[model samples]
Target chain A: MTARDQVPDGAATVWQRAVRARERADREEQLADKHEAIATETRTELHFRMAYIHRTTAARHRVTADLLEAHAVRTAEWTRRGGPPPLFMTGVAEACDTASVAVTLIDADSNQLAAAASDEPARHAQDLEYALGEGPARDAVAALVPVAASGTALRARWPGYGPAIESLGIGRVVAVPLQVPGDCVGALAVFDPRSATTDITRFVWVADALTRSFILGRDAGDGLLGEIDHRPEVHQAAGMVSVQMGCHVSDALELVKARAFADSRTVGEVARDIVAGLLKLG
Target chain B: MTLQEQELAAVFAQLTGEAARDPLDTQALLAALVESSRRLFGARGAIVQYTPGGAAAIQTDGTDGALQALAADAVGWREGPGHDARTTGCALIDVDVATHPTQVRWPRWSPRVLALGHGRVTALPLFSKDGPAGSLVLFTAPGSLLDERALKLSRSLADIAGHTLSLQREVSESRVLAGQLEHALSSRVVVEQAKGILAARHELTLEAAFARLRRYARSRQRKVADVAREVIEGRIELPTD
Candidate 1:
């Protein structure tokens, strides 16, 4: 058959075919664009969060803070995380609820913490893992693999309490680890009663953003939320400065921050040099 | 609750509920106000003039098309070069048959509005934190009944409409301005990055980096983007930095 004749013989009527073809094209283009975006955003979210910590201060904090606030409002699922998590988790839970999905981070040691539970029953169910000392979320953290359990089946696995969950009408559960740098601090879990969890791209984005943020905060160790500073890279760059100048990390930081201050710039500006291997510490 | 009171309360509650949704569509709301107020208040015809800081009123022969024509004529007045926010608020030219123009308190808006309509009219100022956002100027057919309930409802509608307009305006304007800010910051980031690279590559100061970029652009006859793209791409690195 000619190339035109090779078209499907009776896939659908002409009108149907056109509609289907248009739909398929739209779907493909949307999928492709979204696919590229998720990939770009996945990488950029980490970089951006790292950049943020190196940069965040009173003046520059407005946009990111507004964004974090909006994200909490946007996430509609986190209300159930029980009396709210720690302050950070409130925002995180807000984000999870907005997306109607799970978000989690585990610290260096495999401990269940820093979780914002959007679906309350899931939090209660998750506590089964913490209280009784067994659950897939913890396992996923240790294995660094996401865990999914169907509501129908999870009840059977937890036998004594699984039936209670079924009674509460909870449907599905999913947990993704907030992994970044050397530490995997916690995992976020989400559940829904009527729908199985999908559209996890948002939660994944949150996890990536917070993971890098958590590490940077931990490393700053200066009684500040470091990793989100966007200047930690400056600090890391300072580490490179210490190595190049044979000085202490603290001295290197002081020098960089001093230069930034002298010029009314941020520490990240000066630290970029040491990290890029282009400038030696003065 | 009594039946009549319950009905009134329910209506109030619904109006309050609808008022809460964000990004309240102002254009859709303007059209809705014209239709519903005309029907609810039994005006011969109504045109609720809406603007950024004020509004006007007009009378029609009990048809939307007549109202539409009157509104169109009013819009035509807006295009002339001299018209301003003040003139928009008080004018009364084509709104009714040549009635005595009342340029009393808000002279800017009052005189023009009287020329347009022939009726007993009231224009209430609508203000948000900023100054007046709009007004609720309704025309009653000469000698029509002005019941207290109807007056309160009309005033309430004006407050609700003005608040909604303010909110929508705030959201959209903020979104646009924020987008602009984000774009500027992103560009600043490029400038900042170029500054960083220049600072590192040439062991020169950041101000020095900027001067080098400016000097190179002046000498070579290239756009700033060409230079920035070069710095960012690592091709035409500013050695002067």
Candidate 2:
């Protein structure tokens, strides 16, 4: 037979045509025999993927909630355990993380703002700018709106913060502006040095969520202040990166940023190793 | 042909008959096509190009110089054997590059085929979803002919390759979305953990504890997650603000 005559029609072949026909017939027969089982398998696979996505989403929410919940839980533990009242800076610094944790309030002038930062050298790395009267947080506060630093491939945009931030080993971070409508004032900055994906897409989702929380928690602000434990490991890592890299504390902080991301390990874990003398940076 | 060759031909016909229409599945399709073609046609090298982009187009199994040249040249045809692919055009399938008739029909590409380790070449244009994706070409010694069966088999395999590529693109895009979702959730959990540490130590409300932490981070020049780790570690303590 000529090839044209032998070849079947369309996206399937002649033999496939027969197989598909038979399969369809058998499927109809099986539907009559066991329809529920087939449906169940389909349902099960769909549920598996849906559950995975849901679990991932919830995990993100839970961490943010945990920060809020820490207040009550830690207070009881401290009171129950009964230690001398922890120092205020110690408590606040410890609570700060790459997640949504730090705060920014406009100072007396209302035009300029001051920052209360966490102990993360990466996060603290940027506070130097606000301390020096310039940075994303400072601009966000003056602008009186949510400001962001989507630090991507080209980060020289933040001029002063860029080179300084680079030394802290941070690849990318975002500082969102928080202000009430009709009352443009200081802002809150949460610095997250992410190394997971190419973009700050996830960080943006989280920062947005935290900003909402800030707006919602505004009335509850005065009542929310609490004591936090100091995060020695992070500072220690910053110190180590500084010592090893022979850079300032800020530069040392940046070293941890690159290391934490490159190894896919947390800055904390790497810091632990440094403290224990398990690994060293080149 | 011998009985073995005929039997092999029959198996190929059956597979192509099955996928004669659809190129999506047909598992074990491409390798089978190559093996069958090599045996049936006594060819030296063959390329199956599907989804051709002039510059950005991606090809599978066409790691050869000729195919790369075709992509770079952006020409439709050169001479006796090569295939020229464009975004939109009549799919060209030249089954014999060294043959006299094809050699005379195309002037430029003929010598290039001789330069490439093969004396003969045939190029086929594959049309998928009614669009010009790319072409498939078979190369061989002077004795080889672009037989009907070999051409049919390679064409079918090319279809399968195209389907696989489409699926891969879909999968990669989904991964990007999934990664973003994961990142969002992790950051939230960390923030919450820091809050717990702050509240417990300072004897304050959760929100207030967060504010204090934010305040300290602003003052200390650090990241929020970085600060939270410290609060949990006791390196930097929080004050009751």
Candidate 3:
């Protein structure tokens, strides 16, 4: 079969998005050049700042295009091989020189609204953070800065989460806040990354790219390439618990998390039981 | 830098610095633009007719009240060099208001403009990526024309203002889109939570709970998310059975 015919429909669509992103990046670059020309001619600081803004925007679009293209190629290969579907975060993790990465979208209060992970360990690590109510991702988002912990410091920083994630064989972690102009929307967490990969600047660029192009820009309608997991079951369980115990939904959410931690199970497992009417909590 | 270059630099800095302070205040930016144009070009008056994304605004600056008033009214009449330049996306260079062709072209506008003590009009188009954004009109004394150098300076000023306004519009649009996305996500979460609450309270399936929630919201002419929030908060309990 021809390469075009061999590619899956989803991969084809992703490839098309990649092409569009590249075109937009080129346009942004041209705009930056025009602004730079004006700045040079007029010798004004304002035009120079405008040029910088356009250059930064162009860089973000370029990164997004690269990521989308990588995802499309991986997906096409996976379709041919037929095992598990390729994840969008896998390319992100590779960019950071790690095997595991997780992106967590948060509400204004720094509560995680959704999450996507590159692999099972990263997924488990995210769940541990949700159940324990603390982790690098949460800290990075709350403080609006990068958070890093390794070895003993990990356990020292997060008594509950560090020990739990360490048990899953992850020793080092780093996370950066994904910020827009006036808001911090999410965090990107790297698990068991190499020491060389701890360059915070690289992580920041990836976080910004994900926030601008994937989460909140024109491509946001695709829901981060359909990789984001909003964990509806957890919220639903919180609702059921709230009605059963005559408490607020937020309080019920905490109760559900507490139950999951106490039972040594993932939040998703406990939430599924609660939603299925097989479990109840006060 | 030459004296002229230094003055040009200061004007650009001032225009952009003020805009940076309050990017959303398009009126303030337009007013500053016209005032700067009037002073820089040594015109009797300057008028800017800006319509960015359908929100039209007319700003005028001059020592003569009659000429400024006429400039504002000319936008409504669609009869000045500003209107022509805006519609055609081309600059009008030193058109004598008393000329026969100018009078015949704008019969009502040319005579009133002449009576206001202005004899020459020059208009530069403000262009954006989308198309013609607006035009900048400069009125001068009889027999006084803007030289080639002044016309070039006017075009640059108008171009920069147009680019800034376009950037402002893009930022505003993105902000709106981001807000809507956040709202939609939060609303969906609330709706899901409300479904679970109703399901447990009435021993109904989640689907049935959602149906009841929608029914109550539609009946009251309210948003489902609002009704759902109330349900989750225990403020408004839907009827059972």
Against the true structure, whose TM-score is highest? 3
CA deviation > 4 Å runs, candidate 3 = A1-17, A37-43, A72-86, A94-99, A145-153, A171-174, A190-202, A223-225, B1-23, B54-81, B84-89, B92-109, B119-122, B127-131, B145-156
- Write candidate 3's Cα lDDT for A102-157 as tens digits: 99877777777878899999999999998989999999988899999889999999
Full candidate order by lDDT, most accurate first = 3, 2, 1
At residue A256, candidate 1 shows an lDDT of 69
Query: How high a TM-score does candidate 2 get?
Result: 0.33
Error of 2 at B238 (Å): 6.8
**Chain B alone: TM-score in each candidate?**
0.59, 0.53, 0.90
How does chain A of every candidate compare to the true chain A by TM-score? 0.41, 0.41, 0.85
Instruction: In angstroms, give how far residue B104 of model 2 lies from its true place.
Output: 12
The best candidate in terms of lDDT: 3
Query: What DockQ do the predictions score, one after another?
Result: 0.01, 0.01, 0.48
- The collision pairs in model 3 are none
**Predicted structure 3, TM vs. truth:** 0.83
lDDT tens digits by residue: candidate 3, B73-176: 87779887888888789888888889899999998889898887889999888876578878888989999856666666667678777777676665555566
TM-score of each: 0.38, 0.33, 0.83
| Every candidate's lDDT | 0.45, 0.46, 0.81
C-alpha RMSD by candidate, in order: 22.7, 24.5, 4.7
